[model samples]
Target: MDNATAKNIREGLKADCTKCFGLCCTALNIVASSDFPINKPAGIPCVNLQNDYGCQIHSHLRNKGFKGCTVFDCLGAGQVVSQVTFKGQSWRENPKIREKMFRVFPIMEQIYEMIAYTAEALSYDIPYALSDKLSAQLKEMQSLTKLDAEQLLSLDLVMYRLPLNKLLTETSKYIRESLIAKLPGTKNSKNYNHERADWIGKKLRGKDLRAINFRGAYLIAADMRNTDLRSVDFIGADLRDANLMGANLSTSMFLTQMQINSAKGDINTILPTHIERPSHWIN
Candidate 1:
């Protein structure tokens, strides 16, 4: 898929809270931790959820110890359930179907996430065969999202996801190997050590971080402006308040909406086409 087409598909898969019924706030359980301030059961409505399905503390979630909310993205699942499956019938309005709605919400969320990942994988400069397979699978997963509530409930999602996951793994490997081959030195490049490193508030501007494994690295408040981060894996990197101005991460590996939301960025932060800048970021 071309960049523009892929971008449009990705934008369609983004969460639009205005079109949703606060599924994440109500359907999912919130436990007491550094991420969440209170404990709420799965079927219970969050105390911060307003009557119109809006989060009262939406702008202040992180400040109120609900940082988890800021990081959570359903990838347009909420609206799919609220608008398509339920046909604009909210659980609050239709109390009889509330239980079933909650049950189906999580399932749709997983499916949408899969679709988003698959679409993102197709956007990369991958081999034609892999791209074709991913594109076909993306269409299949997208069609599944349009299924009725009963069909979605009965879907063996795991079976459908296995092949897609395998293809994505292969794509990642191919992209990483291709990137590594183009680095400054074949063997002795200065790689970013991201294993539990304390890089909080450190200045690391304009560095080449391609294919670096940043799983669970602490990059809090780090100045990462103009960094070359192609193929860099950010599986579980903590980027809270990290500055990413002018950083090119359009082809970064395993980067998610949660990570982007947790970090600070401006107009100059060049992100992947699929991911959007956090709303609270300074322009």
Candidate 2:
């Protein structure tokens, strides 16, 4: 990356990080590994993390079993939720506020994901005339980052789209129509609302469903026996007690740290999200 590009990325990271407190590492658990020494529970602190909220093993996280840490990018998501929303109080400092903290974290994560796409849009040199509107939207997003847990969850963030919806639509069309026009082997995939399905007892044994979108799918008590689900989208899926024996989700999309905490899976269950895989089960 060029210096300008690198600088921009750094600024983005700084802006976002200023609002976060490495909550992904602190609020979540990881199995014992060379990277993370202790297997902690959700709402519990890592053994190596300092009381001041800095990682005791920050320098050597990679040398430990935390090789996954290097690749995991909250994309400035963590910092934003941590500092901006919570007002500099970390979950570690106030254990009594765990539930509220956890609840808000995922919402902020979603907003950050949207911001990431917006940042990418900006980089393509969005029209100079529309630049002022984009700047205003960016400011609004930044302000939203400062909301508390309940406030964030209650706000209809979609409203921000009202001003730039048409512009963004045209911009997206330009990208898809111009840069991505007629690209070989680049077929756009379709999304399905396979919700409320009676997957109660059906055996989905060893299915190759990589990148399949399963948002809001009702998978209650489903027998997902060893499915290959890398990078699959599960944004709002209801997976209460879903059996995921030997299933691979190494590259799943929208599998936030909060959602994983809410779901039940064993070691044999492959997870694509960045949180540490729990250690209780064996493949």
Candidate 3:
């Protein structure tokens, strides 16, 4: 696929809550914690949901101890389930379909998440061979999203995701190796290992952290200004209050909306095109 097509697909996968029926608030269970004010079971409507399918405490979610809600992104799965899967019929109106809708929402969510990741991989300036493979995989994944509800439930997404994940991994490897080769010297390259390290309050300015495994690392209050973070896997990374000023993360992988929401950044923090800077970030 061309860059424009890839961009369009990525944009379409973004969450549009206005077109959804508050599926995240209902389909996913929330445990009482620092992030959530109360415990809510799966399939039960959150107490904050309004009659019109809007969050009554959306603007004040974090203030009211529901910071988890502020970071949640359904990746357009909510709308797909609300409109395409059920033909715009809500659980409230069709109580009979509520159970099925809840069951299908999570499956669609996994599909859309893969779609987002594959589309992002296709946008990278990789070799023609890799790009062609990614394009084919992207087309296949997008086709699955159009499947009927029954087909979606029966579909083996794990089978589909395995190969796509392989492609993404290879793409990340190529980008990281390329970036590392361009670094100034061996000392700089040798000093670039921060994978799963305790980096709290550590100054990591201008570091070449491409393809580093930061999954579940504690990076709270670290200085990460002007860091080259391309292809880094940030799944489950705790970035709360980490300084990301002027950091280039446009090519980062597995960096979810929730991770970005938890971090602190300034206007200069360069992020992936699909992600928006949190409003709480410094201007």
Q: Please, what is the TM-score per model?
A: 0.83, 0.47, 0.88
Ranking by lDDT: 1, 3, 2
Clashing pairs in 3: none
**Candidate 2 on 49-121: residue-level lDDT in tens?**
5655566766666566554454345656676676666767777577766667876776676566555434434
Cα miss at 93, model 3 (Å)?
0.6
Clash totals, every prediction: 0, 12, 0
Please give the lDDT score at residue 9 for candidate 1: 78
lDDT digits (tens) for residues 1-283 of candidate 3:
7877887778677788988888998999999998898999999999999989999988888899998887778788889889988899999998998888988999999888888888877777789999999888878877877888788889988899889878876877776667777766763546444557788988989987766767568898889999988878675578877888889888776677767887777898889877889987789
- What is the C-alpha local distance difference test score of each model? 0.83, 0.57, 0.82
Question: Who wins the lDDT comparison?
Answer: 1
Name the candidate, 1 or 2, with the larger lDDT value. Answer: 1
